[model samples]
Target: MTKNGHRPKIVVIGGGTGLPVILKSLREKNADITAVVTVADDGGSSGIIRDYVNVVPPGDIRNVLAALSELPEIYLDIFQYRFDTSDRFFAGHAIGNLIIAALAEMKKGVFASVQELSEMMRVDGHVFPVADEPLVLNAEFSDGTFLAGEAEITAARKSIKRVWVTSNEKNEAEMPAAVPEVVEAILGADQIVLGPGSLFTSILPNLVIGNVGKALAETKAEVVYICNIMTQKGETEHFTDADHVRILNAHLGQCFVNTVLVNTAQVPEGYMDKEKYDENLVQVEHDFNGLREQHCRVISSNFLKLKNQGVFHDGNKVVEELMGLVGRPNHELRHREHS
Candidate 1:
């Protein structure tokens, strides 16, 4: 707990729609949040911006800002508003994305831009880019395949063997390192949370950064992984809850997660509108025995929310579980090895 009170310093690590979903609730809880978002995105508005600006993608950062923002709805609406297809001059570009791009140029880096914007947006917490600059996500699949962008990797739809990160710039000699503040946030937090996003892409992209993974391994803070409600098509099409933890453990080089939140509520068959919400998603299955084998303190619940024919983790329900652990670390050393 901070000198201010018992409000826990929470560092959320991941990117994608799932991130903002939970963040909005955490803000209401008045927890000190530091969202360490992925920079490996190479799709849609973010990809286009990165290509032209040579900066970290801003899409995920933009959504997170909105979630943590206390600004009036109209300002957020204008910030998020995307131009219509007919408007070629600004088509498909979000106003927020452009502002972030411009901010990156004005401030000279993604780190500073996010720092400045967080204040402007009246954000309740911190937002850190996973790295100092833009990074390209690279992957090797079990079928001996290779792909470079996050979009391309997912489009290939092969079983991913592992994923890694490197600077997006040409002639870069080494893998990129996570910004120091992000690692500090991880180490300083009372609790650390991962996922509810694409396991290999949105979530793993941040962890694959050497320093970020190192910090996670060494941090005494209690680590919680909120398992995704659905398996993605090109990613974890048939992955069990245990598979998710296994991949995270495999990448980090240890089984460090202290708790695994699994959704037990079933999705009604044919309830998902596949065409509308296509990420090749299916309800995730749980291997309780396997999770126990990983020594994970499993917390299963009906974390299901059906909104617009899509399956999502109920944000309120998820937060309720997280609050139970606020300012609490290693209350029971049943899972992870006691350091």
Candidate 2:
């Protein structure tokens, strides 16, 4: 337990770049970690693999696996390796995608494939795809022209009115069984964290799953939403901190979440060069009165950091703040009052 007391079991739900970072940081602690990642990814390497092979996109899963790997630097290079130039067999493919696909084929189930991969990576904890099926995320605009697939939904220039999931493999409207261990982790967790990733695509995709949402709503664990450092141009465009919570609560409803973690440190001016950062940082704005009425406590901290050519939550800072909330009951202690 890293010279500390018992490690808290944590179940982090999300996908994309943020989930890996979250996992990487938490793995340093004494927590039993489980990452429930989204499988709706249909961009780049993951897309190519899913289209040709008809399996759940494994890009995010691959990333999470690598992040939790004991030999991350070595295995990550191998797993993340992409073909430098388009080729016949390796065109736009990640080595990890091929590895996961091959494993899924050999093992007969995505769940088993990931379990095998997790052991191979020597990850500190567990990782599961939110659903067992190849999910096609659908977003309906206010105009009623619905867009399907994560890639297509992201390409839409307009803001989405609502988002839901459907199966890419014919008429499969339901999500695959929630990995049993994931539900167990939630029910047994001391703290559960949501995003620092794309709200709809990365974060909500997991929530749209039936049992995933139910587990999230039913778990007595203290739920924490780590607000993104900046807004994505096509996704969160101009979302405020409060808007982030509003949308998540809207999708998962009030029963699922009890607390929020936000970056109180605004990006220093000019971090957003037109040629560089997206130039859209998330501003802090909370529905104080309403949130208080609903009993959802908002936790804020200066946890932003510059990394990997984009802004992110400082790994150490995130873990420190999250660890503070670990085992701490959902009390009405004010953010300032606690400090």
Q: In order, how many clashes per candidate?
A: 1, 0
Best by TM-score: 1
At residue 317, candidate 2 shows an lDDT of: 87
Measure candidate 1: CA RMSD: 2.2
Model 1 ranges off by over 4 Å: 1-5, 327-339
Clashing pairs in 2: none
Write candidate 2's Cα lDDT for 152-184 as tens digits.
777786677778787776657544556677677
Give the 10-residue window scoring lowest on summed lDDT in candidate 2.
330-339
Prediction 2 TM-score vs. true: 0.90
lDDT of each: 0.88, 0.77
Tell how far residue 259 is off in model 2, in angstroms.
1.4
Q: Give lDDT tens digits, candidate 1, residues 1-339.
A: 333478888899999999999998887788889999998898998998888897899999999999999999999999999989789988899999999999999999989999999999999999999887989899999989788999999999899989998887785687789988998999898889997899999999999898988999988888889998888878998899999999999988888887889999999998989998989477788898888777787889998999898898888899888878764445564355322
Local lDDT at 43 for model 1 = 91
